[model samples]
Target chain A: MVVNGAAIEFKKVRKTYGNFVALESFSMNVAAGEFMTLLGPSGSGKTTALNSLAGFTDITSGDILIDGVSIARVPTEKRNIGMVFQNYSLFPHRNVLGNVAFPLEMRGVGRAEIRKRSLKALEIVRLGGLAERMPHELSGGQKQRVAFARAIVFEPRVLLMDEPLGALDLKLREAMQLEIKQYQQQIGCTVIYVTHDQGEALTLSDRLAVMDKGLIRQLGTPQDLYDRPNSRFVAEFIGLNNIIKISGSKHDGAIVDGLGVIRFPSEIQPSQGYLSVRPEHIRRTPTGGHPAIVRQAVFLGDAVRYVVETRNGAELTLAEPRSGENSSLDPGSEIAISFEENRLIHLPE
Target chain B: MKNRPTTLLLLLPAALLVGLLFVLPILGVLSLSVYGDSGFTLGPIRELVGSRVSLVVLERTFWQALTVSVICVVLGYPAAFFMSGLSTKLRAYLVYLILLPFWISILVRTYTWIIILGREGIINRTLAAFGFSPVQILYTDLAVRIAMVQILLPIVVLTCLASMLDIDKGLVKTARSLGATPTQAFVKVFLPLSLSGAATGGIICFILCLGFYVTPALLGGRRSILISNLIDIQVHQSLNWGFAAALATALLIITLACLALFRLLTRGRTEFSSLGVGR
Candidate 1:
């Protein structure tokens, strides 16, 4: 539809239901046409933020500006936004074409124009052939497609999705994810997506905010969060990683982490915190590092993951690619591992 | 479900009860109209068609039943809508409140209406105290209609409330997000979805009104008498059991027709009106 999306700004918004604070100083600025996902576990402030923007939930304080206009007093209908609910929520009384045409009809569009736009929107979702079918006749995936068509039929400037693919099966969910990205790109509408799935957030978002307990834990691109997570929670949430607590750090490269004093990489140092390293970064060496024993070996098709325990009783995982001429390790096999010191990130407790 | 013998066994008690209490009597009544001691004849049907009083009373009864059903829908739909918005606990309590009248005997409820609308009753007595003279509402068409409505309102309300509760609230929220005003959402989405329930309830109310005898017998004036009252007179005063059986057969046939229509209206609507079990 080539919509010129609006820039959205949430200025220190807060929402509370009696004693439960849903959002506290939740602020974000989304550029037009950007896909920003709010990623979190359930009960985080992400959904509250989206609901407030759509006027579904009132912000206790602070203001929300779309493009530059304050919409605090604006009703949900007047907000001029479209939302795709988690459940399809297609009107059972209407056919697919009718469902897609509803928004335009509400705006009092001409019949011919409404039909033209609705068909075009349905075509975008690959559901043009099922226009005459009732909602229950369509399968779950088709219903989701029709819901998408209905949301974007009017070509709203901004769209909100609340775990829209939560109901789909694994294969269908993966397929729909790619389709949703393509649709968003074609429409060029700013999408504020909410999901608890980290993989979905990584695949679709231009930027994402990870929230926990009514606050944003971290906000950045997928690469930034994956490569250098700023907290232990984010490190664990974003990807599989090994975190070793740094009990002490010396003026040189020597760091004590309860195991023994190991000479860490000096160039990126000068702190006492946890050592965050990805499994792929720690590799088995021919000799002299830390001696460990493999506890479990799991076959992951592309790589073999081994759970290894150090001499000090710390369990750490490491993965080795199957592409190379590498032999799989058995449980109780003795091995020595070394970290890629330069890739290790320091996180404050 | 496919076990035929078990299915018949499960239905045995109900089948026996209906056969003894309902079917045999209905067959006898219907036979009385067509088969007399002399020979099988259409004499009772002919007399029913020729009698002007019987025809007028039948037409009046039909109109009164239709009016009562329509009034029940109009009054009950809004009350149901209000109930559906309440909290779960509060809604449960209010449903009991509305059903309170259903616990009382229909005869008692009809008589209670007399106390409210009769001369020297509460309404007329209050009017007199306010310096207006007593009005003749005691044994009028209005009094009968009021009593019938009060007696049947509970069924309509429960049916409407049931369908309203089935509706997914997400549809309304989705409508609002798609730029529909609240009133437009309710009119275009909620109203159409809920109409099936109201239609079924109206048909149920209409069927009940068709055979209504007690309220009209007690509250209606001579001019406002319905088909049931006429049938009563034919059996008791005129001692014409054949004509009364014919009138009753007509009422039973019409009620059956309405029940068929109600089934037709409620069955196919599930295809569209029932929002599919959400994804």
Candidate 2:
């Protein structure tokens, strides 16, 4: 099947519910055939943005364009954007084949073509044999797959998914994530997915926008946001990080009030902010580094995580592979911790 | 398992009430239909079959009930649809409005329709002021149907609204996202899901219509007398208890048959439970 991919653009879109602003001046250009995710906590406007694009919610201002044409005034049906909701909203009265064929039927596709294409769509989702089953008879994963089949049967230009796998179990969720990514690739349709799971966003999206308080905090590739998050929120939200408050600037470093002066990378503009470093970046040394007593050691199967408090009363967490050298570090043991200069990320307050 | 006796004991009061007041009375009526003064006889059954007036009234009763149920569904469905679309606060107020008639007795409501549809009533007086002649609508089948629909409409509307509200709003949104226009989405997705509720409402309305006595007696002419009124005449005017009992049994059987047909039509569908009818 030939899938049409449309370039979607949100040109300063804003949505407000009375005095509450759900989305404020949101703007982004999604490339054709790209799988982009809007990752945020609940009430962060990620779903609102997706709903606005789907024509489910009207924007208070600005415009949403699909394929360079403004669809602000277009009704949801005419928008031709397929959406899979968090709960699979399959019509209970219709069987699997009828549900899958609904979009084609609505678009005036002939009866034979609807049947043939619906079966083909079900085949794509590996649900061909269950065509006669009602939605209530299908398992959760099968229902989700049927929802996917229904969404893509018409080969819409854009597919919007709003936490479609949120209701599934962990194993099914993981498998479906891979399946969705593969389907997006095979169909070559532009996908705008909404989710709060950072791991899911990182694994499934070509690029993602991290949203907070109705604004985009950062928009970049998953690794870009993970490695070089522009804000403390992004840094903490993307992955586990130890953030040390920068009290002041010194001659060649920044002063962390209790941890002494920490050297800053030359590229970092010195200011009152925070120094963020991944837990794995902190290395345990035998001596000649910051002297710290291990407060707690947690065995995580693959790695040993040690929470240490420095002599200056600053606490830091470090992780190390469960090897013979560092696996037995117990609480209250005096250890030294150090970090590479390049691994220290400077995030503005 | 030990609590089964306690459950049965707790159910004793309701069981006794149904047995004494309902089951025994129905059994008496059934026996009265077949038994004469001496012993078992089919005299009442033969009279029910032989009487043209009884047959005409029964046919009229069936058609009247069917028409009234159809009218109730037609009027109630749109009102229920509109009510379901309202916000909770607004919907609560609308439900109160729909149920406002329930506070008044059915006889009082039928009487109010009489005052409105009478020759010199409010509507006819208004028509006279507009220089239009009175249309003789008071003692006609139209008057009884109007009165019946007015009294029974709230039940149908509430039932339909409950079913429509039970439906997931997201299904309609899904339909729209699947490229169905608003009308198509309503016609294809919403209509089918809520039909069970409408059917429940219509069935209730039809059953209620079948037993209608006061409205037809007061508003209907001789030609519009329904089965219930005819049974009333047989018992009171003719002093024929057996034939009246026979007519009552026939009406009961027809009502059960209608209910059975409805159950068959909605078999295996769980959405009908949302109607809060038929368990």
Candidate 3:
């Protein structure tokens, strides 16, 4: 079955429980067939936002639209959405085929057609041979596969997943991430994925919204957020980042605590907040620049990570790609390092 | 797991206590019913089968137990469902409320039923004030059933509630998201999962009802006597110890038969006991 994804809109949604606010003026627009992810730590309203879209939780005041029609008052079952939970909540009493065929049965479809479509969905998840296995008889990964087939069996235009891979081990989780991306592409459903794992968000999302404290801190393509995070929270949350405090304001140069004053490029003003830099952007040299002593060095198969202390006592981490020409550095060895000017991201507090 | 004998040894004390206090008395009663002057005779059994009053009382007891069990399950299941949906704190208090009446002695509670249903009792007096004739409610089959159901409702409700609590609430949410209406979700998912637990509660209520003597003796008429009451009559009024032992042994067999039947139906299926009910 081919399902053209629906466009979802959350307009000024705010949800509160007595005194605690779970979501505040939350809003976003998801394009049809786009894989959107909500990435945040626990208690960051990422789950509340997903629950609001699924109609599992009532919004205090707002409108949720699917395909440009209001669904604020629509009941959950009438919304015709599919969801996969963290534990893969397949009915413990139902077999794999019975679970996958549940949506069709709920819709009063013909028996033969339900069986045919259910088997087809299982084949998509590559579990056609285990259709008759009860849920408890299957392994964890097999249960996850059944959950995926059950969610997409009816060709729902919209699909929601709440940390669907949180229960799997690390290696299996990475494998399922690739399979999930493929399934979403094949079904062409507008997917809303919620997770706290930044790596999983980066790997599977076409576009993502980084949320914190009941608000969306940043929303853009994965590359956009990774390259240019607008706030301190997003910059620190996305990947390994080095944020140095800017002590004083100066257009040409800024006083940074521990590290002495540093000069900025022409037309770039200094902000009295912090300068965000990636570990790879800092390079080590044999001479010149700031003199530093390597405090620690570890090889990570593809790269060598160095944590060095500057002459002014500022600690900075650097990642150098491993190659034949550059030898690994040892701890307590004297070295020189410099930050790339173009790669520096300055944020005003 | 490495010391199997030691683990088994831990069960010896409780097993011995149960054997001494429970199994020995049951053995004594069984032997008395069969071991006649001729040694291992079936004379008591023959007499029991031949007696007309014993057959009629046994049938009445079976039907009464069946009706009461069905009523308890039908009525108590919904109450348990409503309780399961409540907040944990409120549900805890409500569970206490349901069990509060149970702490009082069964005889005391049964006597209260007499005051509520007697000829000059609260119900008949209320009917008389409304210009209706006072109805005879005490010393009748209805009076006995009403009191029996009242005394047994809590057990059924509690058993049903325990299994309901074991269910993951996420399954219901998943069902609704998969396009099942709330009612459909309950019928197709929740009901089947909890059916075994409810059946377990029904069997327990039936077993307890079969051996009941207090409520029937106090509230029932001559036509409403059960198996236990017949054994009471055989011992007290007729002064027949051997015949009473025969009656008691027959009741024991029927109760054990119901239990064995339940075990047979649920032999390979461990979900009911696995939920930690009846523990």
Candidate 4:
């Protein structure tokens, strides 16, 4: 009912692109200075939510409040929110200085002050020497930095990024991710970043809302979603997991199921009657528990992913460390399966 | 390195055509403008500068062409922007509407203008039916300007619209998100980005206006005679090839100079290469 430091609130926001609904009664609270990511696949209303906050698109119904003020009728310019597009929309005609000075100019800052502020922002993004260079002259990474400098020069209320790093190569993308995160922290600017890359969302966001089919499947910290996913979709989407469809209920310590009674000491009861376990938590046993056959084993650098066949005829994935010669398991080799009961998570069916 | 021969071969046909038609004729004209007269003298060249009639007609021609070019650019930019903002299907339909007049013969278009601006044309008839005396609208400077602008408007609009389409909409959206009003965004970003195309269009319109004869002759009485009309008068009525050649050479030289100035203005800022105006 209560959230801390949440300056922006979306109260049942809905957006419809003609007959098809883009976002349906979506609601979330973005805390001030908290890096929140709207994590979802395409058509999942993640962008719709970010656009509503950015005022690029209108909401069919409901109110979006920023700092407790309703910004529903506010124009995009008046919203004073910086946005970095996927393509890094730098003004091609203007030099780097002009691009960064644009927002300050729009605010009616004096010529000298705009220059000072623009230079400062450029310096903040570590692009001081490239102030006079045109956008086309800069590399992709430098262009994004110019975009970032232009964005934060005016000190907007909230920074919304719609897959800003989607255009960069993997190596550059990871580097920019860290740089932008540090920049956000240094400025203490509240940011709402939208990305489909689960790794990006997990690495950058303080909290994230995983969306599916225009609905928020779950909202929590990265570890919370990964370790204790509230829904089956969240567990499957967040990270690699061995999600077994076990009919179970909360018992003394964990959910009791027909195949195996995985125990947990958690005091809360899971209502949906399911248990989830991370792939690393489940291990192989030698002939005591349920009999499973190794279907496939992939040797990663330090990790091996195994596709094992359980006795009840369900396939489950198990991950183990590559420690010795026995690390690689042969397919069709009979083995037993057991899970770390203490690390099991019980979710609603 | 290997791309050079292929590129040159690809351009061979156009290069040959330019050499045969444009370069050769221009060279012949230059030689004739001097040599066709007595002893390759500068007498005609000197007379061109000293003659009050030639100077007056040349000045009027340049001013009229400049005015028409300005009007075309001013009117065409907004029209092009509106066209570019349209949906693909609607834009295609609108482009067809613009090119409809272009496909019609320029002589026909000039005559159509004559029908509209003549003493007993639709406008005068309508005014007469309203019990007002018919105004003398035809054979005036205004008629010539209107006709020239109407004939050349499509070029300006298409040129500007092409460039406007090439502009990334994301830049405008980014400007708006940075707290710029739509007007500011257009003026600061879109306007500057589209300048070279607009300039190219303006220069083309100016050059085309320089050699305008049909519209001015059909629409104007005497004072509105441009250099092209004067050249026609010298050749047909006066039968003076030397003076006509001199005027044609002047028009060519002035047009090229204006184009050079335009290129200088747009150099390193915005390239109008897509407009194909360089050739």
- The stretch of ten residues in a row with the least summed lDDT in candidate 2 chain A is A262-271
Ranking by DockQ: 1, 2, 4, 3
What is the lDDT, from 0 to 100, of the residue A133 in candidate 2?
82
**Highest-lDDT candidate:** 2
Q: Chain A TM-score of each model, in the order shown?
A: 0.96, 0.97, 0.97, 0.90
Please give, for residues B139-215, the per-residue lDDT of candidate 4 as tens digits: 98889999889989999999999999999987888889999999998888899889878988998899888888788
Evaluated with DockQ, which candidate comes out highest?
1
Better of 2 and 4 by lDDT: 2
lDDT of 1 by residue, A1-349 (tens): 8999999999999899999999988889999999999999999988899999988888899999999999999999999998998899999988888899889888988878888888899999998788778898999999999999999999899999999999999899999999999999999999999999999999999999999888988899999999979898889888899888887755666464635665565564535778778999989999998899999999998999999999888788998989776668889999999888778787786
Q: Write the per-residue lDDT of candidate 1 for residues B1-279, one digit (tens) a residue.
A: 777998879989999999999999999999999987788989999998899999899888999999999999999999999999999999999999998987889989888988899887999999999999889997888898999899899999999999999999889888999999999899879999899889889988998898889889999999889998999999999999999999998888878887887787677663452132110
- Model 2, position A19, has a per-residue lDDT of 96
- TM-score for each prediction? 0.95, 0.96, 0.95, 0.92
TM-score of chain B of 1: 0.92
lDDT of 3 at A170: 97
What order do you get sorting by lDDT, best first?
2, 3, 1, 4
Number of the candidate with higher lDDT, 1 or 4:
1
lDDT of 4 at A308: 84
Clash pairs for candidate 3: none
lDDT by residue for model 3 over B1-279, one digit each (tens)? 967999989989999999999999989888888887678878888899999999999999999899999999999999999999999999999999999998999999999998999998999999989999998888988898899999999999999999999999999999999999999899878987787779888998998999889999999989889999888887889977678889889988888898998889877553332122111
